[model samples]
Target: MTASKISFACAPVIALLGMAWGIAMAISTDHSTAPVHAHLNLLGWVSLFLMGIYYKLHEEIDGLFLARIQAIIWAAASLLIALGIALIHMNNPVGDPIAAVMSIVLFLDMILFVVLVAKSRQ
Candidate 1:
């Protein structure tokens, strides 16, 4: 399958994991990781799935190398955000910086995605 398809396929899996994590947090009465869980579901699952749909609907987007780059950045940033939040929830000193960096990366990734889409339509 194409990278776009792969990215889309990952959404539900991430969502399920996020749901499980939320349930675990609820059971444990710990909402400390709620930010990470929300990000996983929104950015990791929803955004990626939307990107995939865009690529699927517009074949021209699939031809752009930026599509692959966007997928890579999205996946990597999602992991970093999740990991960073988990670390912060556990009171790790390095977590804040990592999450901050990943937040910037996520913004840039979205910018790149927008550029790719705009270019594809031209």
Candidate 2:
């Protein structure tokens, strides 16, 4: 499947998982990891869905290795950042470094996304 299809397909799955997590959190009465849940929904679900839509709309953006690389980096970084935030909330010192590095990856992914979209328009 194409990168856009991969992105679009994963979004709802991630969103459903996020919702289940939220419900579990509510039931357990432990909102300590709300940041993780929030990030999972926002970064994993919403942002990914939007990026997929962008790719779908811009046909000219297809077949670019950077687009696929961005998607891969984004998916990995999102999971890392969310997990890191959760771990950090639980007082794990290692979480900070994990999130910090992944944050940079996510930033670079965004920059690449913008550049790809811009180039597609040219």
Candidate 3:
């Protein structure tokens, strides 16, 4: 499947998950994991969906290897960071390291995305 296709498919699923998580938090009256929910929605849903739209509009870069790599990395890092943050909020010290590493990975992935967008023909 094309990178755009993957993005389109994954974005909504992650959004649904984020929405469900938010509802659960609200019902429980515990917003400690709000950061995780926000990250999941922003990075997993919003960012991926936007990138998918960009790829759809720019056919030239839709199937580029770097674009595909960026999409995959974005999804993975987003999930990992959310997981790490969730764990940290639950009092797991290990999540600190996990989140720290994923944060750097996510930042580097965004840099790659910026380069891809800058170099796109359309």
Candidate 4:
């Protein structure tokens, strides 16, 4: 595998980190860690690697607007996820706005994923 693939593999590391952090939070009674850990796992790890794979194999996507839509959704999802994770970690109430944006980004990403899968099957 190339270095990019290796880097992609590290995405799961973030999920493991989230799990570890969650365990720590569970024992410590810290209110901040649960959401932060969840975001780290779901966004930092899973979504990031998924986006990279999406872009890398985009030819398989097979739609006129899919590329642009994927780009926008991926970028937005990454940015909002990072921002939301940070806000959550720092105990900032700004998470509401960040989460809202991330939610929309995730929705778009899911739609694109389904469309790409359907197209690839044809």
Q: lDDT value for candidate 4?
A: 0.63
Cα lDDT tens digits, model 4, 1-122, are 33234326556666676677778888998856566677767776776577557545645542346644554555456546656766866778897688777878777777876776676634
Q: Which residue pairs in candidate 4 collide?
A: none
**Which digits, one per residue and each the tens of the lDDT, describe model 3 over residues 1-122?**
67799899889999998999999999999998999999999999999999999988887888989989999988888889999999999899999999999999999998998888888885
State the TM-score for model 3: 0.96
Task: Per model, state how many residue pairs clash.
Answer: 0, 0, 0, 0
- Candidate 2 Cα lDDT to native: 0.85
Best model number under TM-score: 3
Q: Which stretches of candidate 1 lie over 4 Å from their true place?
A: none
TM-score for candidate 1, residues paired by index: 0.90
Ranking by TM-score: 3, 2, 1, 4
Q: In model 3, state the lDDT of residue 107.
A: 93
In terms of lDDT, the poorest run of 10 residues in model 3 is 113-122
What clash pairs does model 2 have?
A: none
> Which stretches in model 2 have alpha-carbon errors above 4 Å?
none
Candidates 1 and 2 compared: the better one by lDDT is 2
By how many angstroms RMSD does model 4 differ from the true structure? 5.2
